[model samples]
Target: MAEASNGFFSAYVDSWDVLQIPRIGGFSGTVELPGSKSIANRALLLAALGTNPDRSCILKRLPDSDDVNVLRNILPALGVSVVAEEQGVRIQADHHRLSASSGEFYVENAGTAMRPLLAVLSALKGSYLIYGNEQMNRRPIGDLAKSLQSLGVEIEASEGGCPPVRVSSDGWKSQEATIQGRTSSQFVSAMLMAAPLSEKEFVLRLEDDPVSKPYIDLTITMMKDFGVQVLRKDYQEFIIPGNQRYLAPEQYEIEGDASAATYFLAAGALPGQGPVRVNGLGRSSIQGDQGFFRILESMGAMVKMGDKYLECSGGSELKALDLDMNAMPDAAMTLATLNLFADGKSSIRNVANLRVKESERIHGLKTELERTGASVEEGSDYLIIQPPSRMKSARFQTYLDHRMAMAFSLVSAGVSIEIEDPGCVRKTYPDYFLDFLKVAQK
Candidate 1:
């Protein structure tokens, strides 16, 4: 079957490098994670659409990861000038909109980029068509489409509720738009970031319980940092007064990803004499995913978290427990890795919300890990993990999911594995291969 399109863009990608991961001691060095993919992509859209009285908008702590880098590289082609520096990225959009005619641009699997960018481009009142690869097409954006429909934006879909979604912007006439927050926080975030430009304020109510409330909260916090005032959170109800234009901040820095820290943290606890230390992250901040460290403790991992650093060192046999991952689904992948070393069965529940994301995380992770000699059981909203009597080496299929590739890399502790599409790690961690090597051999 032909790869799915977002309705317009297309690309042929294959034959990435062959990759290998080895069992290493726990990590002990301070690892600097790339900027938050979540925040970096969101900030980029705001900056691209933002107007400044004097100069272009400057965004900081921009990660050198592939996803952000791709967006930066394609911005100029799409008619926005992006200035790249070690310190940050700057853009001078000058209010020129994202039109459909902008040369062909492929967003890869950066769902954070695809969803919000679609909404922002839709509000620009111009014809702009966005397309991506197989994985990007697989990620569901139908909820986002419905909300855009309510705002008078036009979307054309390909299949599987997939993209090739040709979106055209119309001057937004915001009315009360309710979102189902139980699925993915990105939908809520898309509306929150784009609502500021609409003619009428938006009254967004969460149709059911909000699963990833922290991420939606982070979106608002970042929006405010970039000069958009989103009203306080009232249960599931959120009010954003539209026409509140965004001003590019003199400098905005994206924090290192707390979700990325989970792997190293898990390695520290998984029966290794080596030490693992995560660096360049605030010990405390608004990111709710940071709370995953608490979950690690509950799983019997030895952890020491500080103001700006966290260290995990393996001390005893690890046992798993039922974990609620709704607020931090990104960390769920790491939890899957740690579960393999567990002495007893463990389950991570409430992550049914992850099915329609950049990948079907639960099934993909479970299916792939099973190839590495693990007894895996999948439930609608949870995973029951039973470790194999002994670990064995096997090929690990990454399915183009960066987290899937990284999380499964830990299998090297028990097996010598080959990972296909290992290059996918570039999505968020461009130097992941190098970093994994340094930490493993050290």
Candidate 2:
């Protein structure tokens, strides 16, 4: 397939089997990032839940991606009105309109959609068979299902706790439940979003610390924006009073994706004429991945934080450091690849959850990094990488993960590389390579 050009850089089209990313001298440009996938989906669900005949929620800057589209497309089946506008999407829903409906929903590898939809559907009068693509079925949802089962919702998953979850319930029959947080914070967030639908106060306890606690925090923050309050005790327990419903804001604007900004930030931190600026995310951002710029600063990158933007420039020399990345598992992949430009070996710990993401990320990262002549030590939950004396040009397999396709693009800073399945980025940022080409200089 020929690259698409519109007066600027060429972009890899979906029909292309492989994308050749040439060596770039440096990065220098501003990228206006798309709406965050986490916030977009959460806000979409909340908007739909809060929707009424009189009040239709207008969400601004909602990302147009496969993940967000999954929820957008499925909301109408529950009798919710979702209209796509030039600016964003408008959701109109009434709980009274929701009836006892039964159908199969294909979420297509979107965890944000599958996990939350499971809880929300169970809260409504419905028999839902929520399944996803092959990879999504391989991912676990049993922990979330078990928690809902505790609330008197009949829920079941495939053997080994995978997806294709079947949920049948009239509504919440119990008020108290406990969820194991070790696997995913989405389970807790899902429960919290549905708790307000209960007749009595809902109390939820955590069995363990969640892998991505910031995501839960983001969920609560967005929930509050929708006029729901959740009381929590040090992230261990949560209390959401019943007899409340989300009040859709007249207009809610979603911030840019911080996770996607990691790529540009890492590129700016490379040795080049950099100083790349990513607009729409800044110090006041709610996303945990916004902290990724600080990781670059720790690696000797000059960083500037504004109220609504983050800027980065390469420092004197990049330094390696060991850190626990449980909070920012998504950005850890960029950090792992960034090691190629660092001065020493680096260790990323406490991100075992990567094993169950869109792909087996931990093992996949180890494989691809080693293919590029880097020495990688793979553990059950950690990866230690020693940068090679010299980087090599190699073809990187994306494993059908969006992050994999984007994170490995950093290799273009040092060597010409080929990325397989560049189309995988459609899961989140479809125009990733187009934006990447903006900052890259030959």
List model 1 lDDT by residue over 1-442, tens digit each: 1222322111224546446544543455557776777778877877776644355777877888878876777666656778876666778763444433434557887778777777777666667677888878877778778877876777776776678788665566667777776777888888888777675677877777877888888888888877778886664888887677777776777777777777777777676534677776667656787787777666666777777777777766776788878888888888887788888888888999778766788898888878867888898988888888888787777767888878887777676667777767778986665566555642
Q: Tell me how many clashing residue pairs each candidate has.
A: 18, 0
Off by over 4 Å in 2: 3-16, 94-100
Error of 1 at 331 (Å): 1.2
> Over 4 Å off in model 1, which ranges?
1-16, 77-79, 96-105, 272-274
* Candidate whose TM-score is highest: 2
Candidate 2 has what TM-score? Answer: 0.97
TM-scores of the models, in the given order? Answer: 0.89, 0.97
Q: Candidate 2, residues 122-206: lDDT per residue as tens digits?
A: 9877788988999999999888888898878898899898888888898888889999988888889999988887757899999
Models, CA RMSD each: 6.1, 1.7
